[model samples]
Target: MDLDSAFAALGDPVRRSLVARLAHGDATVGELAAPFDLTSQAISHHVGVLRRCGLVEQRREGTRRPCRLRTDQLALLSTWIDDQRRTWADRLDALEQHLTDEGADR
Candidate 1:
């Protein structure tokens, strides 16, 4: 999944909250909906976005549908952040070397 789609899915506070809840343990849709004032359908919509983003997975347990966190997708986020950090560090190091070289010349 693209980062844009994943970020869009995570843009909603409700979706983020639902993901946080799922991180604790697998929970049924009804159980997941309990903390919010929203309807089950609303919660389902949020969950759908999260599932599409690969952050969560759902399975039917008899009549109940339970949702669980899939942490592997988080590695994608981690990787992106790490890449940006490395790029910034490289630039900073270059700036430091340039300053040191100028000082030596002075």
Candidate 2:
């Protein structure tokens, strides 16, 4: 997964909304664009950004191409976040311990 591109793609509110909408279920470009005032072509461009980032994918169902969220990529992002959280927590604990020890010595 290209985390850089994925983060960049999600930086836009429109693209973020698209991912949030796709979370519930798959949707065609028309359905995805219904809530927004933008044209379908504009929405399609957003979807293309998501597709390039590996966050969203479209598959043909009859004549319609439905977009679906790629949860695996999301999981990777989640894992990375959790790892960072843990790393920081550990560092903070160590800092607290050092401060306490210094105070006790003085």
Candidate 3:
């Protein structure tokens, strides 16, 4: 999914908390909903959004559906971060070269 969808899915505080919980381990819907003040239905809706964004996965085990974090999507975030770092490194290298050349001229 695109970054916009990922960001939108994570925009909710409830969704963010849910993701954090899933990070520890996979949990059933009931387990995920237990700590929240909201109803199970509300929690389910949040999970649905996360699923749509490719951030979480849900699987049925007998009768219960367990939710788990899909970390592969996080590669998109990593890729973006790496791109930013590369850009900064290039700029810093250019500045260093400029300074060194200026010093040599003095």
For each candidate, what TM-score against the reference?
0.85, 0.94, 0.78
Evaluation by TM-score, superior candidate among 1 and 3: 1
lDDT of 3 at 34: 97
Of 1 and 2, the candidate ahead on lDDT is: 2
What lDDT tens digits, residue by residue, belong to model 1 across residues 1-106?
A: 6788888888889988987898799998889999999899998888888888888899988998999988788778779989999999999999999999999999
Pairs with steric clashes in candidate 1: none
Off by more than 4 A, model 1: 103-106
Q: Worst 10-residue stretch by lDDT in candidate 3?
A: 72-81
lDDT of each: 0.88, 0.97, 0.90
Candidate 2 colliding pairs: none
RMSD of each: 1.7, 0.9, 2.4
Cα error of candidate 3 at position 100, Å: 9.8
In candidate 3, list every pair of residues with a backbone clash. Answer: none
Q: Candidate 2: where are CA atoms >4 Å away?
A: none
